[model samples]
Target chain A: MLSIVAALCGLMLVATKAFTAEQIASNHHSYALKTIEHLLQQEVPATFSLTDLPYGECDNYIVNQISAAGYVGEIQYLTVWRAQQDTLSMRVVRHSETPGIGDFIDHQRSPWITQFDFESAQAFTTLDGVSGATVTSNSVRRAAIGALKTKDIYCG
Target chain B: MGEPKTKQTRTFSDGVLKRNPAWIQLLGLCPLLAVSTTVVNALGLALASTFVVVGSNVCISLLRKFILQNARLAVFVLVIASFTTIATLLLEAYAFALYMKIALFVQIIVTNCMILGRAESFASRQSVGKTFLDALGTAVGFSIALIGLGGIREILSQGTLLAGAELLFGSAAKGWTITLTDGGLWPLAGFAPGAFIVAGLLFALVKSLGRASTEQPPMQLKGES
Candidate 1:
């Protein structure tokens, strides 16, 4: 009986893994492309093709995706470069900040995240809360600065 | 305990309505109430619970002859845990977002009295076919209760139906969201306390209807006389 139970249980799990492996892999691979498309304000790409510069790319500009330590965990963001352009743009991809309060840093949750769309991270270094999410705001500020530093590390 | 012969139809209907694991029976209210904040969440959890219950019940019924009387409960738990693991893995591999949304709750399904109760009481004594029917009925009842509570909370809290539908149903379900009010009010309805109030209201509504339908007078107390 124990053997029967073990065999059945093992078979079921093996079958389940076999079935869902493809979709799980697909969802992971598409994460980068999805973030890129959202930042660029473009249609879903027919194919995913990314060009990494010494710095992050905007168009002909540089781009970088970096993670910064927040209150609890790392906050990931995408930075697009600006050459002739005056302002740089970045979007939060994931974070582990408190919900309802800190989540304001998310552009989807609130437009407060749009404050970081700049050529440099200087102005946003001491931004006040558009709402009341100061901790999350600071994390986003740090992340933007982190994105800028990547250029120094690579190109400069 | 000796097996009490039950009519096949009654056994099935009892699990579905008269003894709904979530609503009428209120067997597994913790995860049921917690995750029923949205249709997508409710649907995902319901699917997971059903898969575990049905799978466990079938296994218990088939193994009744082989399992010792004293060890039945222990084995039943082991069986329930195995199926729960299978359900969790399936969710992670195929429905990644849904898996993350109901992350903590999936394991809690093992402690759900509904699945264990059915395994020990009915599945251990009944035919595998009959146990399957009972599990199906119970699962359907659970799904209905979850969807009802989820609908109420979502409509009241966010003024939307099927918000984040893609979490369960995939990308095509992205457009399933429906706007209710200009913006939904009573956001608290999606929180823990809100679930308690809504559950109380549901019980009240059911009790009132039960009262309205019962026409017989109270039975006399012969023992006192």
Candidate 2:
């Protein structure tokens, strides 16, 4: 009797898990997209794509073309905002970091992120440091500089 | 032999105080250590564990007689795994955001020693009523320990109680987040070391209290010569 009851309950639970798998995947995808959109406001073209390039090889034309320099590091750069476009907005999306402390750079509380708003691509190398989150801050700066350099290459 | 009512009461009390799965027995340390990072996380884990424990106890007790003696362990695992899967699904459907945050830990509950421990030690041999009471007592004790650990971590680390209140208590409690830290200080409570230290302190405190209660001499019965 007990085995029968247990089996029945077990079957019910499995059925529920099967039913919700799709919903979980959908929610995960939507959440990821929203996070990306929030960080890189719509001023840049919405048709942008993400590509993984080697640390030293990322083509940051904005920094290289405008300032004659590039960054060194394995980074992801958001190539948005053509030079012809009056308004330019771009950013590096994510990085590996310890939670809570280093992760603050990803959130709005960190001044480091907003510094990218109006600064020239050359300013990426000289942005003020985020006191405790220096490593994460540097990573973001490198990625941003590389991205801007890449943008200048393709769009300039 | 049928156990006396007083013996059953004693067993139930033991589940709550003397042999609590979290504080005293020290079972299910995985979820206890992982999810206790925040009050809401701990609360959600506690509720889910309680449901599985109690539900399994009841179901197992009902099936005790007919279960093959050799296959009882297999039976228990299946029953527990089933409940855990159901819990994961329910969280996904309704509490989608929280479900994502606690995804890995929820599945890990399948291996929590406390649930399997109860099945082998108590549920397989006890009456349904006694098993129910025992499971309830054990679950409540575990919940208390989890919430206590979670509350301490949440307050000290984030400098607030219920920093993300809406996740557990709904939007009405959205503005209830208290700022304990001005984003200053290395937030120790949010990390793994913080969890180990807090759990260690709580364990020591409970152990000392248990010693004190046991040291007290029993009162002499009025009719005893």
Candidate 3:
């Protein structure tokens, strides 16, 4: 009887673990996509594809279909840009941040995040800081600037 | 030794005032430190822990007859672990956000010596009613300590009574947070070091009072020697 009870409990634990893991992963993915869409807005192509770069590699490229945004003049603000006929804006994705304090940068609560939209490459090179999360805000800014600098070499 | 009623009441009072787990015994320091950062977090954690401890004690008492003398420790652990798992699942299903915030601290409740200590020391040899009262008293004592610690930390660290109200009561409390714009240096309250200092001070205060009461002379009875 004890063995049977133990087995049932073990099975229940495993089932719950699997269910929660899947739910957490799905929630994280949808949240990441929402952040991406908020940043790119209408400039993003409807059928753009996502690619995972090699681990620890600096440069990554995303192919976007641009319709409204123009090329050359608009290319500098391209945190992530593709060079096929029309220019498409691309941005590097970030994962994980301290809750409440550092995580607000991912949301529009801080207008500084919106500065990436329709920016010149020069302007994009220097993102401003969020009032509270200095370290996280600076890190995001530095990554955005690096992506803009390497856009031509990777996307062009 | 006398009527079970009198003995049970004594056990209950012992847990609440004399042998209080948090103030006197100082058991379960991990969750006490980690979740006491906010009033709501502390309250939620305290309630969850109380449920587990009480449930485990009752179950252990019921099974005391069947448990082998040498395997009592094993049985106690199994019972506590089972209750802790149930608590975790309930939290995950209903309070996902708070569950995430509390995280591993919830599981650590299984190892809280207070629960197992009660099981071994009180429940294992007591009647069901007595064990139940003991568990209730201990839980109340633990909850009081948690709430006290959380209140101090919240007021000092965030200058608010309930800083993260939504985490406990849900979206209805979205605007319920009290903001203290001028809240000063709460470096001790927000960090781990602050938790230790506060817990130590509270423990010391309780211990000193206990010592003082014990040392006081009893008044003479009218007919006594």
> DockQ: which candidate is best?
2
DockQ of each: 0.24, 0.26, 0.07
Q: What is the interface RMSD of candidate 2, in Å?
A: 5.4
Q: lDDT of each prediction vs. the true structure? A: 0.74, 0.67, 0.65
lDDT of 1 by residue, B152-207 (tens): 99998899999998887789989999998866689889887998998789866865
In the range B1-225, model 2's lDDT, one tens digit per residue, is 287888888777777877788877778887888888788888888888888899888888988987888888888888888877778777766676666556557776788888888888899998898899899888888898999999888877876677776776678878987777776244787788988887898888877777787985432222111
Residue B177 of model 2 has an lDDT of: 76
> Model 3, stretches more than 4 Å misplaced?
A1-156, B1-7, B213-225
* Displacement of the residue A118 alpha carbon in candidate 3, Å: 17
lDDT of 1 at B63: 90
Q: List model 2 lDDT by residue over A9-66, tens digit each.
A: 7678667877987886666445544544554442323443222221122232121211
Query: How much DockQ does model 3 earn?
Result: 0.07
Model 1: per-residue Cα lDDT at residue B77? 85
DockQ of 2: 0.26
Best by lDDT: 1
Q: List the per-model TM-score of the A chain.
A: 0.66, 0.46, 0.47
